[model samples]
Target: MSQTNDYPLSAVPQSARKGFWSTAFVLLGFTFFTSTMWAGGTLGTSFSFGELLWIILIGNLLLGSYAAGLAYVAYKTGLNSVLLGRYCFGEQGSKLADFVLGFTQIGWYAWGTATIAIILVKLLELPEAYTTPLMIVFGFGFCITAFIGYQALALLSKISVPAMLAFIGISIYQGSIDIGGLAQLSNISPTDSMPFAAAITMVFGTFVSGGTQATNWSRFAKSGRIAVVTTLLAFFIGNGLMVFVGAFGAMIYQQADIVDVLVAQGFILIAVLMLFANIWTTQDNTIYNFAAAGCNLLRTDKRRTITVVGAAIGTVLAVFGMYNMLIPFLILLGTFIPPIGAIIMADFWFKHRSNPPSLDKIKLPAFDACGLSAYAVGSAAAYFSPWIAPLVGIVVSASVYALLLYIRSAQPVAKPSAS
Candidate 1:
């Protein structure tokens, strides 16, 4: 399944597999922003400083574990998440997962593009007429980066990651001074409070779906160990830093956005740099995933066309202000996505324990009744369960899938004997 030099298919081929650093950099760029800080801002407003630390740690640990396992399989299989879903959900049926993963990414892309567009307008004091074209420009610009494929995304990330960090460092230092230093802020207790369970859900819900789609980039890993270790490292450190920046900014300046904090502190140039770099890093990856998922749905390798179409669709949605009103959709995405990954892991462990067959080699069913049923059951539990909905979805789906597989395996094989 070799793809052209110009286009890597939705299901990436082995030839395009990247080294650990490249994979890590891209994953880090993907996991590094947009929601972590927002969730941290929410947490800071609700919980005490000590409580926030524990929640961030525990929540991210769960996320890291989830990503580590999925990343390894992606590295070994050389398939994106939607392609992996086909083995469990059926080639025709996987469009559901593709729709969910792809749709959500497009939503995020629109929101990010719109957000930056609005911010740029404010920064430059441009007329309102500029918003729509700005959305179109940024939308198409980001899409082009993704259309160029993983190599370009990784190269941009190499620069964006460090630039983002340098500014975050400066923000932390200035924010600390404003709050009378780290010792003072650390000692102050929170005025508002959130339930522990709700806080944990908030953390996971922020990126659980994106984390599940990690194979979109991580499949490029040179080895399973590199994939697992680097993926976990990115989730823990890259995402955790996002949370810390938000919490620090919120507590000190009553602001969640570091860019806002920089502007208030009169570092307008630095503020502009941070704002562009942060959103661009993630938005391009979002478009990349959109193209991958589109390729899966259309069963084609024309990634560039899909990228352009996705960017256009997202830009239109942003213009209409539709992307921001999709909190419920995002929540649904969190609940449903984890089970897909869980089923993939269970199928690999139970059915292909000794040797997992490649897509071309395996005799696959049209759809696995057990896998599809298990996913539905998991989604129901996630919606109804009081706590840790994503976790419940994973555990229930995996357990049900594994049990079905075990039952099938238990049927005795016929033996021929001499009488």
Candidate 2:
């Protein structure tokens, strides 16, 4: 029996690549998240059903394209985002990405841990005293699959993805029957107003952090085409389905989470099952993301150890009530996180021309002035932008990086002194 560290510090070897379905299921499970549904619920209250569809499609398309571009780079280089940061952000500079990305994933993990425990206690009529214990239990429990590494994640997704889809399908069918189908749904007007730009930003912000880190599994893809296509399917179609379900539930019952909607529909048993499956799938992926980033941060191959340690940190946060911090946390993620990915993309395409050298084969600088400067500029622009901040971040970061590159290239070279 061998342990799979999942090649945390290096490229995934060619022999270790995965086929399309294997890759797709892992990514699908990652994107099929409960929080995404919650984001959709917000949209559902602000727009008509038709408008919600357009918002969801357009947002997920942007998310999918971004993930696919990174996936292609991951496939070609056999490196995950944190590993790619070494090339893009430089040796010591990459740790900036490592901490930010890892911290965000831990936030998600803590939120999910606290969410499931709190929801279960309420739904099951358990004593409030059970909440903290449940958080402790689930926070550690969810990371078990991640600790086992990629095979366990894929195995769980293979089972959970289909099961979740079936459950969502059943819920949707029941909702339609209860509401008298599409015409009735169309007549249900929004109770609130939100600007179209804000709606788009919300939708895009919902999963941009996860999408940015999807290279964790995308690097295992058999080819660049496989990586790109699978990433699009997962982030676009799979994530779109989650959002639609959330919005549909919101429109019909004014409940955002599918689990809550199921409960409202008197599918108590089904609600419990969906809750576990939904949260578990995404939780494991989230912590797996944390583990991957942690590994790169510490420059270690001990992924399992980091998985346990990350779960512990997430549990502590959950105990202290990380669930209540979701909105502000998401806003922070939306403003600051997209710029990291944009800088990575700019580094890959413009700097490396999409062919970065092997990590171990080359000596890297402590920091890349261009990447760090571009990220700072991008983050600032996003933070201040009145429009869609994530999009603004992406555009500004890449543009600034390119401009900086041009300035550097234009500078005159000094002649060497005679030896």
Candidate 3:
């Protein structure tokens, strides 16, 4: 049975699906950040500027294409990624995905909030005690934006995106002049020679999860066409810029975040504005993602209430430095997320080969042993393997799942329950 595009879900309803530019800007806001620039710093010192650009561009394209697949399904069904997981992993089994996805978003929210406070302390030359209260203030403040949901995020993005771009533009101009123009900057020798393969993986690994989670916001897309084009633009242009900023900063000023370099260069006011704008765009989505995931996990419609509670939890975690400590773990876990998208893509394309199945019409297991088992194996391959961990995981998981489904299809078709 084919699913209706406008079927009412817990968080997203037909009335809430957004237009192309709104969804595109929101996704662009999510991708635009300072930390991404920081990741570029590492690549800058290691690889030639031309080499780094190619790596970042190609990496974002691959990650975008992978994410576009997930966004396509979300666009078709008006379902978030977690809800879509129910079809492949079983109804109850999806709760596990809900927890993981939601928990990671909370961690990111907390870390982002805490980083703001840290930046303030440094900028003002204040004591560490100021950090805690600052974290509380911004953390709760951003939570309010998220609790208000899409409207607030869209509004914030409208203001912040342009402000951020202008600030970055100024920094780029100043940095280029300081380095004696593009010709000199490009001619500079790399301080360290990072292997070409490692650099590519680093670029891909930087935000592989964000690319996969594109559906979180892309679900609101008016059409799959909008979803794909906008998502690729976010990854290819928006994310690619982040890498260039980081790499450029590192090569010129030994800094990754342009905001940090701005401060060091006596552009304190611009730095403050840039920092807040960069972090706010990412955190609003992070907290909203937690709320959306919470709605799915608890089977509730209290998105605002959950937002408040989740923000409080995240703020508390930030104060304790717990969220900061999880950075490496979170990056490692990102490898596993792409496999979920791959399995979902396989289930929809190979099995149905048309519109998505109606959740109410199709019979599903409480737990899909084959899907879960494949997830574990794929995660292991991503963790243990050296090459293109995400690709490896996707191929392995999809192959395993397709094979299992093929075997199942060979068996007698069980009738769905009437009740």
Candidate 4:
């Protein structure tokens, strides 16, 4: 296949790549920090102080391991994370993976767009009609940013990432001193208490696919070490910072909305910058993935089709006020995301024995009955299991796919006779 327009499909060589620390910084910037804090603050306000900490610690540990494992798999496999699902899912079965991933990207983009719109409206005291158009414009801008692809994204991240970190640091310093000491922080809680499991699920759900994205980004890294180190460092620093801020914010505001609390604390500038960076990086990465998946599905150039389609979808959703409802959207995302990760890991690590044919070399297979059945069973397991849906789904799907593949291979087939 010809290279897609403006998309960085080729891998970067180790000799030509930047140092690990620099790469780590870029990854941290790309991941950004505020979203986690925002999500955590939301969760913390709804849960007990001790419960919130347990969720963050446990959730990040699982998500971090999953992200690392998936990244390693993608590095060794040299395939797009979603494309790796083809081994188990078959060529057609992979489309289900694409749909789940693509829609989740769209949902996140819409949510971020709506969030920016609401913030701008509140900050400037703008009229509803004016703010609505602004939302569409901003949403379209996000699509365009992703259309420019990796280089532009890196540049944007470099600029916004530091600003976001500084803002968070300042906020933490202010909150710590103002809200008494660390011990007093736990005393503050939200009006509506959230369960610990639910909180952990929300945090894990946000980053479960994050590792999958790391694989895409890691393709750009110079070496496997660079890929591994950069990803881990980024998650620890960027994501860790967010969690800290979230915990602090929860202690201070006793509310779920971090932006509101930031404003109240007279850190409005920092709040705005953090919000913009969080949404911008997230939307850019998501649009790129959406476009890549769309291109793969259509057998076309991703850049040309993805930019046009993503922008239209993002704009329409923003105009319709679709993104504001985030909690429900996240809950829905939790349902299907685990299976995708499971299928990818199963295909790369077991089905292919860590080696799959090159993208150009392999011919697409017909829908695999075993893969689909596994997915069906896995989804049901996730829905029914109360603890760690992603973990449960992975075990259920991987075992089923492996067992069925074994059975299929063991059965003898008749040989065709030469005329």
RMSD, one per candidate, in order: 3.0, 1.4, 3.8, 2.7
| lDDT computed for candidate 4 | 0.68
**CA shift of 224, model 1, Å:** 1.4
Off by over 4 Å in 4: 1-26, 33-35, 189-191, 255-258, 417-419
Instruction: Give candidate 2's whole-model lDDT.
Output: 0.90
Write the residue-wise lDDT of candidate 3 on 249-327 in tens digits: 8988898878788986789999988888899998888887888778878877677788888889889989989534633
Off by over 4 Å in 1: 1-15, 326-330, 411-419
Q: What's the TM for model 2?
A: 0.97
> Residues 1-419, candidate 2, lDDT per residue (tens digit)?
13388888888998899999999999999888888898889889999988988999888898888889889989999998999988768899999999999999999999999999999999999999999999999999999999998999999999999999999989999999999986788898899998887777777777888989999999999999999999999989998998899899999999999999999989999899899989998999999999899988998888899999999999999999798887577678888989888888888899888888898888999998988999999999999988888889999999999899889889999999999
lDDT for 128 (candidate 1):
90
Candidate models: Cα lDDT each: 0.80, 0.90, 0.79, 0.68
Per-prediction count of colliding residue pairs?
0, 0, 1, 1
TM-score of each: 0.93, 0.97, 0.92, 0.90
Runs in model 2 with CA error above 4 Å? 1-3
Model 4 per-residue lDDT tens digits across residues 314-399:
76786787755666665656656777777677767666787777655778676878888888888888778887776777789878
- The superposed Cα distance between candidate 3 and the true structure at residue 157, in angstroms, equals 0.6
Whose lDDT is higher: candidate 1's or candidate 3's?
A: 1
Q: Pick the candidate with the highest TM-score.
A: 2
Point out the higher-scoring one by lDDT: 2 or 3.
2
Scanning candidate 1 in windows of ten residues, the lowest lDDT window is 1-10
User: Candidate 4: worst 10 consecutive residues by lDDT?
Assistant: 1-10
